[model samples]
Target: MALLRDMTLGQYIPGESFVHRLDPRTKIIVTMLLIILLFLVETFQGYGLIALFIGGLILLARLSPRFVLRGIRPMLVIILFTLVLHVFLSEGEIIGQLGPLKVTKEGLFKGGMMVTRLLLLIIGASLLTLTTSPIALTDGIEAILSPGKRFGLPAHELAMMMTIALRFIPTLLEEMDKITKAQMARGADFETGNIVQRAKSLLPLLVPLFVSAFRRADELAVAMEARCYRGGEGRTKMKQLLFTGRDYAVISLTLTFAVIVGSLF
Candidate 1:
């Protein structure tokens, strides 16, 4: 339950910081570039540089470091599994032994690097949502995709769907948490068995969750219809988005830093 509440992926924290003030389009493009840079990064030094960059962003955003990182808690199991898999399966110079399994230096390095990459990726993405509002994010996405409208692309519709999906993530998680607690109160056991048993235990949870999700979707559709919410065909935004000098400077600096880090390390 605490884990669900800790998730900050789709939740926005209102602030008057530099990051929060940037044009959403600039932030979106920078985030995409950072993601691409992550894939190109192959050295610890490069990762370190990227980490510093992200840390600077966090500072500029005036966000709590602990809050920004709390989202990683839910992913710890998967990250640990990845590390263990790499350590035991990858063949290299043996460093130690755990029973019949051998630990290798190369494996340790690869696993650590992979874990760092994942952490940075998550933090970068989280920062984007934390600083930008849902409406702004939708506008940024729609604007970026608008050029494709010539090819019959429904840019506005796609952007709206994406934003709504992100917005619902936390809502769904909270719903799941409530359902779990309710089931536990009724003597349901979700944590007492082997992997297979535990999975089977979730059957009851999934059924109700799905039903709830569908119900919410139906309700949302009805609400939108009631409000006469049409697609972007004749839509005009209440708040216009325009890039400023700060946005251009941030974008330029980010690109330059990414290029240098990619080339140097």
Candidate 2:
């Protein structure tokens, strides 16, 4: 699978790496801050620093260097489209010409900036999911959003839903793959139809997928009910997350980096 080869996002790899050891809440907070900084930055210098930040994280996480490259490679179309949009629409001094279009010096720089921001954001966000388990991620989200409960927000439910959706991605993909193979074995042509016909053919595939999803959901609900499951009102975590000296050390370093970058550019 392309995903198995490239995007490790949302797939937890077990290790004793420092990144794997940090509190999930710390990783979540750090990732959030990095994403905010990505959007707020505009200068090339700023992007350079961000690049270094994310690059360091990839190294620190002990993820494959191939992974960082692969993460960006599949998204090349999106980055190129973003660059092209900026090139045609941005107004500036005409530096050169591309066919019937004009290329502005500012547009090129802006395109570079846009592409860098998007790449970093994707890689950073993916790293969080890669290093943290779905359960840990859900707990972190609930903990961070717990204050919203006073405003009647369903923080715990939302967290559970999000984590479940992520956890289901690989499961659903495998299911679809199996279905496609079986259909092919039966001479169900999914590839020989015209665009519209192909679209129609997909109906057979989707019907089974939806049915499987619902069946699994029902099984999960019944299992939870059987175990006397309730809402988050007074639920106690079997493995309660706690911040240690390492967590504070990581947070302190993140704050320091944020301040330094903000001041520099």
Candidate 3:
């Protein structure tokens, strides 16, 4: 469950700096462009450039690398498990041989590459959310999806739901954490048990969490209706976002990076 919390999909740290000030739409576009560029990075030189670029963004965001790495700590076990599995299962000319296991240079090379890619992808995206707010990210998502509304898509409504959901993730996680602590206080033991017993202990934790989540949803629905919240029609933003020169510069630099990385292929 802690690993689930560490997924980093919707985790947003609050900030008011320049990166935080950019329109959500601009940030989403720029982030996606950078991620796409990452796939184009193959050679060590390309990876080095990508590292430098992301490092610069980290500095600009004023976020500690330690915090970013902390978000990835829970996944370290899975990463190592994967690397080990790939190294042993992959067939190649034997680099070393034990009693029943064989190791190959090719296997180690491929597994290492896979793990590195996973680390970079997670850390890179985490950097985006670490510097941006959930509201801003949702707003950006809605802005980017607005054009789809013309094709009979409920883009605004979808975005609104997503925004609200993202806004609640941390709150819900905190709630779950508290609930788990309460259950533990009542003699619910998650550790020191077999797999089945450990899983069963989760039941007590989950039941109250689900019931409370439902109650919250019902209350939110009632509140939304009380506010006469209709769909996207006749809605106006109190603080409409406008992109500036810096936004364009960021986008242009992202595009140039893409081109340079693409040339490496």
How many angstroms is residue 264 displaced in model 2 relative to the true structure, after the best TM-score fit? 3.5
Please, what is the whole-model Cα lDDT of each candidate in the order they appear? Answer: 0.91, 0.84, 0.79
lDDT tens digits by residue: candidate 2, 1-265: 5746565566677767889889999999999888878777778898898888878887888988676566677677889999999987789999988797889988888888898889888888888987898889889989999999999999989987886787787799899999888888887888786899988888878999999999999998898779887877777878898999999998888888887787777
In model 1, the Cα lDDT at residue 156 comes to 88
Task: Write down the worst ten-residue block by lDDT for model 1.
Answer: 1-10
- The TM-score ranking, best first, is 2, 3, 1
Q: Considering TM-score, which of the candidate structures 2 and 3 is the better prediction for this target? A: 2
Q: For residue 225, give model 1's deviation from the true position in Å.
A: 4.0
Model 2 lDDT on a 0 to 1 scale: 0.84
Ranking by lDDT: 1, 2, 3
Using TM-score as the measure, the top candidate is 2
2 or 3, greater by lDDT: 2
* Candidate 1 stretches greater than 4 Å from native: 166-223
lDDT winner between candidates 1 and 2: 1
User: How does residue 124 of candidate 1 score in lDDT?
Assistant: 97
Q: lDDT score of model 3?
A: 0.79
